[model samples]
Target: MAGNKQPVSVLVLLYTAQGRVLLIERADKPGFWQSVTGSKEGQEALLATAWRELGEETGFAAAQGVLHDWAQSSVYEIYPHWRHRYPEGVTHNTEHVFAFELSEESTPRLNAREHTAYVWLDWQEAAQRVFSPSNAVAIRELGRRLSPLS
Candidate 1:
């Protein structure tokens, strides 16, 4: 826990049944917005990491709504500035994807330390607003999943 950040993480996309998606602006990076995301700690399961991040970032627990494990993961290079959080040789992260769908639109009680603002937008708009490509892809997939027809 002290030497390096885990290379594994979870990315959670919070959305409504009607396809509205939530995005949070990073406190440290201002305009850099994304869905719920954090690295796994200890031996935590990916599902647990998803729920923990969801609660930490949005104050929403898995029991409050439906949490779907998309069973998908992405590997990407860690940004340079954030690399110090990880081990010296760690240049990439593997992010598991999850989806939380609320019955309706609702406000999120954000963690001020991690995020400064939050927004709920149409899936398309949410996808466009996110600074992370993986977050955008998850949003678009949410849109496709909630569409009238597959």
Candidate 2:
């Protein structure tokens, strides 16, 4: 029997206090860059999914810095090519957003199977560089959070 499809996932925006965001090029898809993302395994909490994905994908653990749940979500259709990962008839996924703010830029150990390389860029460039719409939305939201309130 196929496992239950997890509708919840996490999209973690890793950034520096200076407002630089980290983006990784996907190994499976050349030129496609994105932040850390993954679905919850079993019954893990949403935040746990974020932390686990961050550590798994980038070697950055949220325990060392500020990890804020933006309390935002986006539901979108799962791409046709990658739909096999989910159970049958699972066509959509809801991604919860989180941000990990570091004091300075740090080296990230990329999982070669998942990513080719990683780069840190200013929020604007990062937003434009990411391929996924939900990731771009998270980056824009991060910009808003970091902006001054006047």
Candidate 3:
């Protein structure tokens, strides 16, 4: 799938009721921690893309947890370093946000090809640790979601 990623993608944030967010360190770009993320396939539903990416990147099957589509999306300029993954002239992408809530933080079967390390941190700290702006935004939003009254 080299240089063929769709401009539309999914960002699945796996968290617990306690607000601990799961973050994975990218293998190709170590120290870049993020939630499960990937591009959509042709004509695929955004929900399906989220589920697929969840399993592929973190080994969490759809049946293992319930996915919540926050119905949130953000369009941003793609990072120059990874822009080659998309077609020529494609400089931006729309990322749809989804979330999977677990009762507790569980060990995920991390895909070594994509990630080298994993950590579960409080939403605030996770938000600060993510490298991508959009990813950080999503994580920060997680706090609001878990505590809409706070």
lDDT of the candidates, in the order given: 0.90, 0.89, 0.93
Model 1 TM-score, all chains together: 0.95
TM-score per candidate, chains pooled: 0.95, 0.93, 0.96
Q: What would you estimate as the lDDT of candidate 2?
A: 0.89
Off by over 4 Å in 1: 1-3, 148-150
1-150 per-residue lDDT for model 1 (tens digits): 324789999999988888888889999999998999999999999999998999999999766789999999999988888988998788899999999989887889999999999988999999999988888888888888898687
Give the CA lDDT, 0 to 100, for residue 34 in model 3.
96
Best by lDDT: 3
Residue-level lDDT tens digits of model 3 in 84-119 = 899888999999999999887999999899999999
How well does candidate 2 match the true structure, expressed as C-alpha RMSD?
Answer: 1.8
Ranking by lDDT: 3, 1, 2
Give the runs in model 2 whose Cα sits over 4 Å from its true position.
Answer: 1-5
Q: Which stretches of candidate 3 lie above 4 Å from their native place?
A: none
Please identify which of the two predictions, 2 or 3, would achieve the higher TM-score against the true structure.
Answer: 3
Candidate 3: give the clashing pairs.
Answer: none
lDDT accuracy of residue 118 in candidate 1: 90
Clashing pairs in 1: none
